[model samples]
Target: MRSVKTLLVPYYEHPTERPDAWDALLAAADRLYGVVLNPASGPGAAPDPAFAVVAGRLRAAGVRVLGYADTDYGRRPHAAVVRELLCHRDWYGTDGAFLDQVSAEPEALPHYRRLAVAARTAGARTLVLNHGVHPDPAYAELADLLVTFEGPWDAYGSLAVPLWTAAHPRERFCHLVYAAPPDAHVAAAVQCVVPGAGVHPWGTLPHALEPIR
Candidate 1:
């Protein structure tokens, strides 16, 4: 089956401080389906009111925002920590939650399962687990979609692409990377991996993978 494509747009501006950042995002937003409000970096850090300010604007502009909560950022228990994040859905009015820093261990699946269930119960329409590597089939089945590979530009072609292509139904996967690369790089990567694998260009603009296209 062909996969759906999506681009990951940043929560707000670019990390490098580009003035055209908002324009770039708005221009790409209509071309994509969703955006991720990642508070993990940039101005997303806590005590920075920019997250809410930017996320609110994105929502008003008609983009589906998914909050990024890095479980590994603080070396704490994910469930208890994530349970607190669920409230962000209400605050941000986001469509779902994307759990970053996901563990790859088979034993970790149970914890993720619990989180997935919690996300749904909290009325999250989507749940994404960022495993940072090619998804294990067992882990893939647990969440709505899995973030299989998140690495540097140099490794994207040699490592991530091959690892991703080996898996089928790429439509249900996500690749999170910096946007310093061109759109063609993203386009090619998406096509080479899973015809339908969603691309998070600049980690925000979401373009659906349409195999038929």
Candidate 2:
């Protein structure tokens, strides 16, 4: 049977600030591919025991845990990026890395590809690129999922997915919308994206993830 496709959260809160984030994650674990864990500036070199416990719990519950790492739109040196990926692996035992600040240009493709390789080498089974827009189709080949849309709800209503993306499996695509409408509008937001697309809706800034039903 085909697996169910549901929400994917860009969970930006540190575990300390929102301990309830763990509960929210656990409640929706079955519907999620994973949640992104960001601490301090990013996933710092040392691990927090609290985060480690959360990661372990999420893993035991069969949900993938991804460490957040910013590439500064590929401006950061490759070695530095790789170090963060490895730190996430060794420190938090994350199953993958969510590469933030990804660029959509074709020229940046190779840079991301190398990062993907490094992530895999560092024990990341899943690599998600948060391009925050529809990127060059070539990017589709580099990561498991591309976050093609991320903004306020208004923009999401008019969002469009490139024809090339349609050629690939829908599960490889994700959408995130902040300042989302009321719960009544959730279905409409879900309908805006293609079937099998991972969707996340947040009602406020610095969005906290809601359980996906």
Candidate 3:
């Protein structure tokens, strides 16, 4: 049941900037596990009115609206991170949190565990950690979904999934690939494959969910 959403979209563009892309995302809401809303890459200095509207729409469509939280690979202060998560919740009424730049080492587990606890205490119903690689198998327990793979299309085929992944349900993992081939196939439980590449890959809508004209 946790694996119901097959796509975890991190479309970073503002709704006003890309109205069509946001419209397309709304049209494909049924297939989304969640959409990561990055208002100035961590809620900005204050709340964004546009993001709030989009979040409301996504929630109405039965899609989890996740607020983006950058961990700075655990270097950022914990309180700062929590503040961002809270801002996402209070400002946009997001039901989930997308913790990005997460550290994948076993030693960093305690730090993340604490952060995860803070997130839950603050009312994040769904938590996703974007480790961007197959982290220590134990990293799977700190959040609801682990982004085990994140890269370009050319590097995806050569990826080697860790055997430890077999111990957990596939739903526990997600893959994010940009500049992906038109016929790309991702065997993971959840994914976000986009054709847009360069400095920012997530700004474009996934081709699979082409805007409903």
Off by over 4 Å in 1: 1-5, 11-20, 40-50, 73-75, 160-168, 187-213
- How well is each residue in 1-213 modelled by candidate 1, as lDDT tens digits? 533335644343343444245545555555444566655431132433545665677677766677767667324575655655565675666677767778877766777777777777876787777777765468776777777776555556665344534565656766655433344364332222221123533433323322122
Instruction: Estimate every model's Cα lDDT from 0 to 1.
Output: 0.56, 0.71, 0.90
TM values, all candidates: 0.69, 0.84, 0.96
Please identify which of the two predictions, 2 or 3, would achieve the higher TM-score against the true structure: 3
All models, RMSD in angstroms: 7.2, 5.2, 1.9
What's the CA error at residue 54 for candidate 3, in Å?
A: 0.6
Taking all chains together, the TM-score of candidate 1 against the true structure is 0.69
Q: Write the per-residue lDDT of candidate 2 for residues 1-213, one digit (tens) a residue.
A: 643536565555566766775677776667666777766456775787878888888889888888888999999989988888778888788899889889999998888889988888888898989888899999988898888876666666677767897698777877765655454143221112211122433212222244343
Better of 1 and 3 by TM-score: 3
**How well does candidate 1 score on lDDT at residue 63?**
65
The regions of model 3 sitting more than 4 angstroms off are 1-4
Better candidate by TM-score, 1 or 2 = 2
Q: Locate the minimum summed-lDDT window of 10 residues in model 1.
A: 188-197
> Worst 10-residue stretch by lDDT in candidate 3?
1-10
lDDT of 1 at 101: 78
Q: Output the better candidate (2/3) by lDDT.
A: 3
Better of 1 and 2 by lDDT: 2
**Residue 86 of candidate 1: its Cα lDDT?**
62
